[model samples]
Target: MNSHTVRSLAYLTGLIIKSFGISLVIRSRLGTGAWDGFYVGMAGHFGLTVGSWLIILGIFLIFFNSFLIKSKPNFFPIITIFILGCCIDFWLHFLNFEPDGAESQVLIFWVGLLFTAVGISIYVQGQFALTPVDQLMYALSKRFGFSLMISKTIGECFALAFAFLLHGPIGLGTIIFTFLCGPLIQFLIPRIERMLFCR
Candidate 1:
């Protein structure tokens, strides 16, 4: 296959794995990451699936990010979001994995979080288009001269606020994920890149 095809496959694979990890977190009955918390809250409020809310929110974020960056939005991210949304629902529907109790829930949540971080590292290393949510963080960071870390924290805080207002699940897991996921992603990205591309 061509390089483009290979990259596309890698991107899709990463997204599918990410979706599975997210589904695991949700099923664990522990809190999810910020954007996911918002999506789950919106889904509950609107009587839609989490994946449906992801797509709807993703479309809005695409336009919002464009406005913030004062540039044309790259529509390619939509493809990633669409596939991600579908995969999330597919995993949720098909996977019977769930935590059996409080201790198991904590274990499951950490496992899911690690899986998500690894999946994100892989996809980002592939250098395909980013999801709209991630694009928003990049746009804000570039536009305001803030570091990406600060921009991401601010964005996630907003998501958490919305999730709280919408009454989504919030717990220690959310706090843990907010603080740790970025560092984990940074730590894992180089390793994943070496694994995938070092040959």
Candidate 2:
């Protein structure tokens, strides 16, 4: 296969893994990551699935990102968002695993967080389009001279506030995820990029 085909396959693989991570977190039933919390809360308020809300929010973020960057919105990322939304719902339905107790739930939540970190690292290393939420973070960082870490934290805070307002599930897991995921992703990115491209 050509290099492009290989890269595409890798990207898709990463996305599937990412979806599995998301589903695992959801099934843990402790709490969700910031964006997932917002999606779930919006889903509850709108009477739709979380994946549906993901798509809707993804669209809005795409436009918002365009506004921030002062460029024509790139619609390509919507393809990733649509596939990601479908994959999230598919994994959630397919896995059908649940933690039985508080200890088990905590264990599962950490595992899911690790999975999410690794999945993000792999997909980002693929150099394909980012999801709209991530794009927004990047735009903010570039436009305002904030570090990516700061932008991510700010974005998560906004998501947390929106989720809380909408009565989403918030707990220790949410707080942990908000504080740790960005740093973890930053730590992983360079290593993953080298692994992917240094071969």
Candidate 3:
């Protein structure tokens, strides 16, 4: 209706597109991408569709993020991620392609994760409200006076550990994801913003 509304819609659409890419990467069956291993493993355990799990997690994260930042959840990205995640999951049913082995799969996993890093960088550059998990990290760092990077590392480490316990594939991909995502995001966010928005 207004310029602000248009911008928000655009940003939300970008996030959903990013989420759709993520779902495609996950469905690749080469291996679960680093960030997705937790969600996929949980989905497997619960016998629910990955999209269903993603939607549920997205809702919870949005609410939780709101609590941390006092920011209200918007409808666009929330609904988009939910519906697209389910769409991706359903689409994945007809395709089946697992990696060659643990080693080969790990390589594929790393590549998929690199793509995720790029996607995250682009998403942050959009400067929409932070995702729930990102917001939680921001809130924790602000309240505890830790560096945002450190807070993120701590949070990811915990997720990595849980993923391991759940028998999710953890490998060099995990290590690389943990070590590299922060600096990469920091570097790319600004560049992407400038390129996309000239700011």
lDDT of 3 by residue, 140-176 (tens): 6776787767767766776677677776655555666
lDDT of 2 by residue, 24-83 (tens): 887788889989999988988888888888999999999899999999999988888898
Model 1 agreement with the true structure over 145-181: per-residue lDDT tens digits:
9866677777878898998999888888888887777
Query: Each prediction's Cα lDDT score?
Result: 0.83, 0.84, 0.61
Indicate the residue-level lDDT of 97 in model 2.
Answer: 73
Segments of candidate 2 deviating more than 4 angstroms: 1-3
Worst 10-residue lDDT window for candidate 3 reads 27-36
Stretch of 10 with least lDDT, candidate 1: 1-10
Which ranges in model 3 have alpha carbons more than 4 Å from their true place?
1-17, 20-35, 67-77, 87-95, 100-107
**Which candidate has the highest TM-score of all?**
2
User: Residue 41, candidate 2: how far off, in angstroms?
Assistant: 0.9
TM-score for each model: 0.91, 0.94, 0.71
Clashing pairs in 1: none
The deviation in Å at residue 158 for candidate 3 is 2.5
